[model samples]
Target: MVSPSPELALHGLVLLGTDTVYAVHMPTFTAPHDFQAVLRVTLDTDTYRTARKRYGTSALFTARPRTLLLKDLQPGATCPADLYFGRFGRDGEPLGEVSITIEETVYVGHPAAEPRTLRYVLFGREQLYLSHVLTRPPDFDQVVTAQLAGEWWASGSGAETPARTVTVPDRPDDLTGRLRPGEQLTADGTQLQVLAEVYLETADLAAGGV
Candidate 1:
């Protein structure tokens, strides 16, 4: 039988001079056949001081398409995926669009085979990115028109700057030993969230007599 679904969480901190962006990915597996993806974006100004110390600046910001989420996949599975961000004018008109595409492949074990299963692969991600930038962005949204054709990668192990840690400064004479806190502000006065989910149909192979 298939194992129980696992829980995964990924968090990243980005510093924009006056603002900070926190990207959070949380996945909760409900049923053996069901899944859920959650993404949240939080802006904190209180962390400004820490950000400045780390990034060497204080003013930070996000361009547009404030939030995004993509979800649902077996633990070892991968797949080609496409993502798009669109801007809208004050009048609610389409402004421009930006997109990212990823090639993904997924691997699952075959019960009868003991150590191996099936793999799913696709190539549309690259095409989708190209089409969006070369054609869709210009036709749909101009704000992101300049960002149409580009390659992007989703989550994976790669080189990343080490996370810096800071200590709260304590005063010489404070009996309570409380350290002064920094300011915290929200991004664009709004909290951004994104969620993505994937589910595996394990029995499909057996049903197909594979």
Candidate 2:
């Protein structure tokens, strides 16, 4: 089982140049018993259009050189665009470091069209060398949850909620929880509900961080 600590939390963020796509991971609530992780993303209308013009109509959005900003990146403000993983003793001493390497591909479509399919696969790891100060030998167990939201490149597509209010559960395994990847969580312009739990374990925290 993943050991729980004040510093075991990890945040990740990504930004697309063409559009002001902002993604963040936030630690909503935490306690000795459980913790909550929330991921959110937003796309700028103007920039999204520019991306469509430069990139051809396809199914995926490629990577481009865009300005990435880390806003209010506190312990859990949101997912940090830059991956920062470190092992600190209960006393808060650095035991390791965090780094990331990205591989991306993009597919574009018509001005008024949505790509039939858009897919991006991120593969990498974060390494942490446990120091002797750690209470126990690293057991190689960590739980991380990520959430993603993006605006449709085409306007009036109604693909995303103009504004969404997500209610995260105070407990990790609570039935009423926020939406997760692979899980179909949507608000029918009314009440929000979890359609499914498709969010899988995308990364391993202990052995080879994903």
Task: Tell me the lDDT of candidate 1.
Answer: 0.20
RMSD of each: 20.6, 16.9
TM-score for each model:
0.18, 0.24
Can you write out model 1's per-residue Cα lDDT over 3-95, one digit (the tens) per residue?
A: 223332211111121222221111112222122111112322233334334533212212232322224323323222111111112122222
Q: Which stretches of candidate 1 lie over 4 Å from their true place?
A: 1-59, 64-67, 72-96, 100-161, 171-210
lDDT agreement with native, every candidate: 0.20, 0.23
The clash count of every prediction, one per candidate, is: 36, 17
TM-score, cand. 1 vs. native: 0.18
Q: How many backbone collisions does model 2 have?
A: 17
Give the lDDT of residue 117 in candidate 1.
Answer: 16
Off by over 4 Å in 2: 1-10, 26-162, 166-186, 190-210
